[model samples]
Target: MKKISIQGIKGSFHEDAARKYFGEDVEIVECRTFRKVCELLDRDEVDGAVMAIENSIAGSLLANYALLQDFHLHVVGEIYLHIQMNLMVYPGVKFEDIQEIHSHPIALRQCSEYIDQHFGEIELQEKSDTAGAAQELAREKYKDVAAIGNQRSAEIYGLEVLERGVETNKKNYTRFFVLSKHNNPIAGTNKASISFQCGHYYGALAKVLTIFGDNKINLTKIQSIPIVGKPNEYSFHVDLEYDTEDNYERAIHLVLKNVSSLAIMGEYKKGDIELNKP
Candidate 1:
């Protein structure tokens, strides 16, 4: 079985995306932090890792992007997971008895609206991971404490789900990058993630954006990360989708002429857009 590391415990969204992108059969190596996932993959402790790159509501995780480049890991694939944050507790524990709730900071932010409205007086605590919070609650047998996690956490930890789909946005989804030591491209790979460094010259980035448009390549997303130890210099990471390999190649050819460095992060099939059901 393949051991793929993830930023959170088995019941976390990272695990879900890992299983979705790789398969349910793959061995899940849980890591407490996203950086640990990248480190493990780089050191060959695991075959790959599912790293959350961005969320629809909270936006991009800039630190994770830096970790990818710093660790020199490649994006072998991508996964989109529909986020559903639920409040869970010990079995038979009444919701009224819950006075404190804890979860990852992102999870808390995602469900801020629900927390304020329903759990107004609840003491919110931030933990290292969402599922870890539930696992801790179960292990410590804290009946007064609750957790915001996935249903899998409740099932695995033998807890009861008090509330479901508590996230502020029903359309909330997180984009995860399947990182590996190698750039393994698959058939029907219509999407590519590339990072480039542009000169301070005028229109440097604009010129490349034009190249993408002229070549019929869709620039789905772009992020600018600061280059370490280099002031005022930034590296641009972009995701491009093309109808044909020829167009992708042509765009890269033109883009290379305008940038100091161009690295093709990966060429993989685009993930399907998933939304939580009402």
Candidate 2:
């Protein structure tokens, strides 16, 4: 069984993404932090790591991008998990009995509208993990507390669902990358993630982008990360997709001539977008 490292414990969205990508039988190694997940994979302690790269609503995880660069991990695969935040409480606890709600900050933010509408004046506390909050409420038998997480959390931690699908947006999804130590070519690779730094000159960035456009390569996503210790210098991380590999290669070749520190992060088949349901 291949062991994969994921941030947070069992029943968390990270676990959901891992199971979705690696199958249910894949062994899971839980880590409290994204850095730890990358460290375990970097040290060869696990076969792979599942780390969230971006969310539809919350934007990019900037620090995780730095971790990807610092650890030198390659993206071997990717998965898009539809987030289904729920309100869970200890068994037999009524919704009105809840005084404070706890969950990961991101989860809370996703459900902000739902929370504000129903939990006016109620104390809210941010926890390290969404499922961790649910687990705590279940394990400690906290009758006055409720947690916002997924339906899987209620099942894994033996809690009761007070409300299901509590997120403000029903279409919330998080994109996760499967990282590996080696950059092995994957079959049917139609998408790629790369990072590069352009020369500090006029239209340097535009020139690289033009190369892709001229080669018939589609630029799906582009994000700029500030270079450390450099006041205004930045590195560009981009995701590109193409109908043919030849076009992609030619674009990269031209892009290489225009950019510095060019790194091909990964080339893998794009994951299909599917909504996860309870």
Candidate 3:
């Protein structure tokens, strides 16, 4: 069985995306941090890793972007997971009995509206992972505490879900990158992610973007990341989609000539937007 590293235990959304891409039988190696997930992959301790790149509700994970650039990992594929945050508790714990809620900070932010409306003035503790919090709650059997997690976590940890779809937005979605140490190109790739640095001269960035437009390449996303130790200097990371590989190659060749430095991070098929019913 293929082993993949993830940022949380079996029931976390990372696992769900890994299984969705690698199948249910794939072995999961849980890590407490996203850096560890990349480390395990870099060291060849696992075949790949499922790492979250961005979320529709919570915005991009900036730290994770640095990890991607630092580790020099390649994105083999991608997955979109519909986030359905739930309120879970120990069996027989009533809603009124709950005084504290615990979960990952991102998960907490996603459900901020729901939490404030129902549990005003309650304590909110940030845990490393959502499933870990739920697991701890079940292991300790905390009667006065509730956890915000997913339904799969409730089932795996033997906790009762007190409420479903507690996320402030019903359409919450997270985008994950299936990363590998080496570049393994796949056929029928309509999307590509690349990073490049532009000169300080006028219109240097605009010139590079025009190359893609002239070549019929579509830019889906673009982000500016500050260069480490270089005050006021930045690098651009962009996702491009092209109908033909030839057009993509042409645009890339032209972009390479224009940018100060360029790296092709990944070329993979785009993922569909997925939703999990509550």
Q: lDDT, candidate 2, residue 33?
A: 89
Best by TM-score: 2
Q: Each candidate's TM vs. the true structure?
A: 0.94, 0.96, 0.95
Alpha-carbon local distance difference test for all models: 0.87, 0.91, 0.91
lDDT digits (tens) for residues 127-197 of candidate 3: 98999999999999999999999888999999999899999889988999999999867998999989899
TM-score order, best first, reads: 2, 3, 1
lDDT of 1: 0.87
Candidate 2 Cα lDDT to native: 0.91
- Pairs clashing within candidate 2: none
Give Cα distance to truth, residue 156, candidate 2, Å: 0.2
- Candidate number that wins on TM-score, 2 or 3: 2
Report the error of model 1 at residue 88, Å: 0.5
- Candidate 3 stretches greater than 4 Å from native: none
Better of 1 and 2 by lDDT: 2
